[model samples]
Target: MSAPGEKVTIARKQKKLTQTELGDNVGTSRDIIGKYERDETKPSIEVAAKIADVLDCSLDYLIKDINPEDELAKKIEQLSPINKEYVMAVIEAFEAKEKLQGKR
Candidate 1:
């Protein structure tokens, strides 16, 4: 297993879900979510599985040393064609912005 907290935080944010929102979906509280993100506490496997589902990621992504890009590609592959196009446009815009700032 890798740094679970970091993976949870990244996957949660990638889904554009607030900790509170994620907690609500997972039948937990925002404080618990915060604790998980800060690594102050660990969620049970069941809770972790729920978190993964709500975040649209897999337990493997959260608990193993998996490449994040692969997880994201998997999610993107499941999107509708129009939604995929939107994602590509967003990626292009972000890349363009990064280029303008000499970040890439």
Candidate 2:
């Protein structure tokens, strides 16, 4: 499994954010962000949380050894109430269809 720092680096890059930009958002310096990316240093829990916020990812995703589906669930958790309901409904529909087709 990748380390928390590595997860942060990957998520930041996937979001198209530079180290400097991420640092600016997280109230840190580019050098510090670079260090984190290089796995030479670890951020404080608060700073890590801020980084996750800036990267639009869950803290679990950055720090825990979870699968991609867990990450997707985390993303869905951030949706608005109505959107959350809609997404859940869609997922349930798909699951029901799959069950009917003996695909599960």
Candidate 3:
């Protein structure tokens, strides 16, 4: 498990977000984002929460090595009923197509 800084960097990259973009989302500057990534500075709880929100991740994932995908699933679980139904339909369609192609 990596530290928060490494987690931040990983999540940011996974989301294909630039440091400037992430900082902008969190109401900070690119330099501050760099400092956080380098572990030279720690963000306050509010800032951390904002970062997590922008990154579509949980604070646990950011600070405690929890699986980020699990956090993503949690977010999906919170989707509106119609969106959830659409997502499930897409998943079922993909699965059916895969089965037809003999792919797991």
Candidate 4:
């Protein structure tokens, strides 16, 4: 896995956030965000936790070499309840399709 800064860059981009936007949400300046993204400076654990929350990712993904998707449940936690059910249904449909193909 890359450094926490790389993970931050990836996740921030995935969220379609600019450094300034992320900084605004994370309570920092854009320059600080840039420093973090460039790996010139690391955020404190408290700031990192805030960043993770703003990015809708896990602190483990940022600091401990864990994948952000490892917290899949957290990823979908922001979805509406009905949307969450729809997501589950879609996963079930794909699994069922895979099973059918295997059986064939």
Error of 2 at 71 (Å): 6.3
Total backbone clashes of model 3? 0
Tens digits of per-residue lDDT, candidate 1, 1-104, equal 45889888988888988999999999999999999999999999999999989998888878888776887899999999999999999999999999999999
TM-score of model number 1 = 0.63
lDDT of 2 by residue, 25-91 (tens): 9999999999998889989999999998999989888888888887688899999999999998999
lDDT of 1: 0.91
For residue 68, give model 3's deviation from the true position in Å: 6.6
lDDT, candidate 3, 1-104, per-residue tens = 68899999989999999999999999999999999999999999999999999999888778786666786699889999999999889989999999999998
| Residue 6 miss distance in model 1 (angstroms) | 1.2
Clashes of each: 0, 0, 0, 0
Off by over 4 Å in 2: 70-104
Better of 1 and 3 by lDDT: 3
List all candidate RMSDs to the true structure. 5.9, 6.9, 5.2, 7.1
Error of 1 at 21 (Å): 0.3
Compared with the true structure, all predictions reach lDDT values of 0.91, 0.92, 0.92, 0.90
Per-residue lDDT of candidate 4, residues 1-104 (tens digit): 68878889999999999999999998999999999988999999999999999999878878886655756778799889999999999989999999989953
lDDT of 2 at 45: 94
TM-scores of all predicted structures: 0.63, 0.65, 0.64, 0.65
